[model samples]
Target: MNYAHLKEELIEYSKTIGIDKLGITTADPFLSLKDRLIAQQENNFASGFEHSNIDERVDPRLSVQQARTIISIAVAYPSKLKNPPKSLPGKRRGFFSRSSWGVDYHDVLNERLKKLEAFLEARCGPEAMMRMVDTGALSDRAVAERAGVGWSAKNTFIITEEFGSYVFLGNLITTIPFPVDKPLEDLCGSCTKCIDACPTGAIVEPGVLNAQVCLSYQTQTKGFMADEFRSKIGNHLYGWDTCQLVCPYNKKIPQPAHKEMEPDPEKVKPLLLPLLSLSNKEFKREFGHMAGSWRGKKPIQRNAIIALAHYKDQTALPKLVELMHDDPRPVIRGTAAWAIGKIGDSKKEENELLIAKKREEDQEVLEEIDKGLTLLGFAVEK
Candidate 1:
């Protein structure tokens, strides 16, 4: 098999199929990444979302037997939402981060990887490749950085000269022994902007992020948001862009050319009040296709309540009162109770919290109601 000609053919074919960038590298173990990941896990800096097996994550050969080459691909996604609505006092809105704006990128990147797999299989026969997207055991950013697709920025995202860090990455381990490409030189020279701008100091150092306090990971949690993070979340309902927004490489980034990656403005940044009232079926119908909807509507709803509180949306008081008293989910109920405290000033809001405080059985929700009463200047029962 002529691997050089095949590599050229693969790169050419990638452009026709909406792949923004492609690179080839050897399937050798990622020794440096393995050490970093081990330290990251040990120090509790790792986000629990990643595949747990460190061995499978660093070595492509473990995933695809006889893997001699790795094919890394990136699809750029839009960073800006067209015609975004203003999140004002009366009519507040919450925004899904740029990453969750379009169709779930996992689906988008996987679709592209499957096509690449078929193309390689047509040449190398069956079992020549194993494809993976974000959920794959191998780190997409690590693979992309090593494959010359981009430089691994201090924000820990793969930043290509063409697309910045706003790219979805995926890769395939192949048996073809394709000629390798060298990794790019680090371009983040003395840039502490991302680390400095982190609200929770999630970027404890340059490239290492403590995901536990990261606003992006904080928004995706199922339980009540931590006190420090809730106030810092602002109007963000899913993920965050503070790191990328401050990165020098992202300032002049182009809008995505792929239609599937373009965000529907209204859908990505919906009204905050309505989000709390969305029934399960309604939430699914409206946001099911969005990547932000992966944790179901619970996190979004909770974040929406916090957004309303952030804006001090008095108009949301009635709905928040209802959720505080009637919502079955304790996270939703507790968050709403707290939001009412945060936004409310009048006797009507005070009465609502006092009534909830009397009957609320859940200790968490009761504590939130007490907080509401305290915010309203009413002393709580001992």
Candidate 2:
């Protein structure tokens, strides 16, 4: 029953609701995507955060019974911060990626998706459609590509002509049969900027990502990050944007239209030192609304310690030493141990690490203490 007319009406409605782009496609299983997921798993490239059920991830029907069509929507977020806070010298700040700049896109996209779902439910009746954002079993990127929203680019982001890669994606699967749109042509020919610029070489090839090494993934992990990645992370406390920053398509991005997606400069880029002593409650009050806080304060705090070390901020050594000696969480203590050693080279700082090393009981913390001692040209007992 005239699903094409409904699609058109939904498209116009989406424009009014801050949806930057919308496209439609069939709900058939993503066969190639399943193969790619298997290969990614086999290669040990997946980050282990995705839904484990690969079948549900590739087949829309498994998620929405009688699924006949998929409508993908994109919401553009701010590319540039207005009057951003400085990450300078003693007042060094940690960065939250642009995607986390505003309110959590998951919430923003969910709001849009719910609205779209309501629009469809009215026309198609109740229980005929289902909505999902990033957490859903299906790959939003795959749906976007098949729906002509954008080209899946080398950095593994859907790069739309209108929003570049600075957009959020959400989709609806439905029983209604809508006219499908053709996929966009590949515009990223021989452009290896994202791959060449990846700090950990996480982009093994065009359109492929080794999530294990992606700084974005590394920052989200609630453990002592690998020593190799610690230095490469720079000031990133949440996610990394190096790949997108280097992509040519990302230049001159459209201004973010949704006010909810606009960032507060102070919040997104915050002073690093205070983050060290933040209680869970304080952290929640400050960052709970943002996307990056899902893993809670530990990962962010761990990354902040790494960022302080990345800057060699002597000012943070006190807090780092405090954590190394007193913080109950082993990951925090261990990461702080490493950062203290990595940042402080003086006799006083070396003595503090020596004291922490002697008293530290955790094997992981002891190892990090040893590394810190090694960094300061001190010998440790075997």
Candidate 3:
């Protein structure tokens, strides 16, 4: 079997199917990645969302028996919103990071991977290939870096020259011995833009991220947001982009041509108030298709409350009061209480918080109510 000729055919086929970039690499164990991941775990930098087994994450053979090569593909997503709606005083909106702007990349990229898998299976028999998008045990970035899809940048994103860091990466592990492509050179020399721009200083050092403090990771968390990050999150409801927005490599990149990745401004930057009252079914119907909806309504609603406080939108007070008094979830109720204080109309907000405090059963919610009263210049008993 002519592996070189097959690789050429795959590249051409990829172009026809909307894969923006493709590269191949031998499936040797990722020795360097294994060490870095161990360090990340030791330093408590891991987001805990990653696959826990280090061996499976770095070694392709463990994921796919007899894996000989990895084929990495990138799909570019748009950075700029087309005709974005204005976020005016009463009609404030919360931003979803660019990556969550359109249809979830997981679905879009997986469909492309399925097509590639079918093509490979037809040529090399049923047992030839296995494919993965971001969710799989194998590190998508590591595979992409080794396969020459892009260089892993200081912000920890795979930076493709054509798409900057705004590309979705995925891979196919195959038994076919395809010729390997060389990795890209490190291009982020002496650039501290991403590190400097990180709101929480989550980028602890060049090429290293303390995910626990990352606004993007924090936005996805289901629990009460730490107070330090509350103000820094601003109007971002799902994920944050300060690091990516400041990266020099991402500047002046052409808008992606892929229609699936184009941002629907209203969906990605929806009004914060409406989100607080969304029923579970309503949340699913409106946002389930977007990548940001993975953590469900609680975190988004909590962030939305924080965003309203960020705007200090007096219009949101009535709704915020209702959430503080009646919301079932303690995180939502507690966050709303904090927001009410932050967006203070001291007399009315303090009175409402005091009333809620008397009836609130959750200790965390009670603490937030007291904090709210205190923020409004009313003293609370210690």
Per-residue C-alpha lDDT of model 2 across residues 1-382, encoded as one tens digit per residue? 7877888898999999889899999999999999999999999999999989999999999988899999999998888888887788899999999989788989988888889888878777875788899999999999999999999999999999988998899998988889999999989998899999998989999988999999999999987788899878899998999999999999987797688988988889999999888899999999999998999999998988888998999888878888888999999998888887788878987898888877888898889888888888898879
**C-alpha RMSD by candidate, in order:** 1.2, 1.1, 0.9
Candidate order, TM-score descending: 3, 2, 1
Candidate 2 matches the true fold with a TM-score of 0.98
In candidate 2, which residue pairs clash? Answer: none
What's model 2's overall lDDT?
Answer: 0.90
Tens-digit lDDT string for candidate 3 (113-230): 9999998888988766777888898999999998889998889999999889989999989888899899999899899899988878898988899999999999999999999999
- Give the Cα error of residue 170 in candidate 3, in Å: 0.3
Best-first order by lDDT: 3, 2, 1
Error of 1 at 375 (Å): 1.5
TM-score-wise, the better of 1 and 3 is 3
CA-lDDT, candidates in order = 0.89, 0.90, 0.91
lDDT accuracy of residue 111 in candidate 3: 94
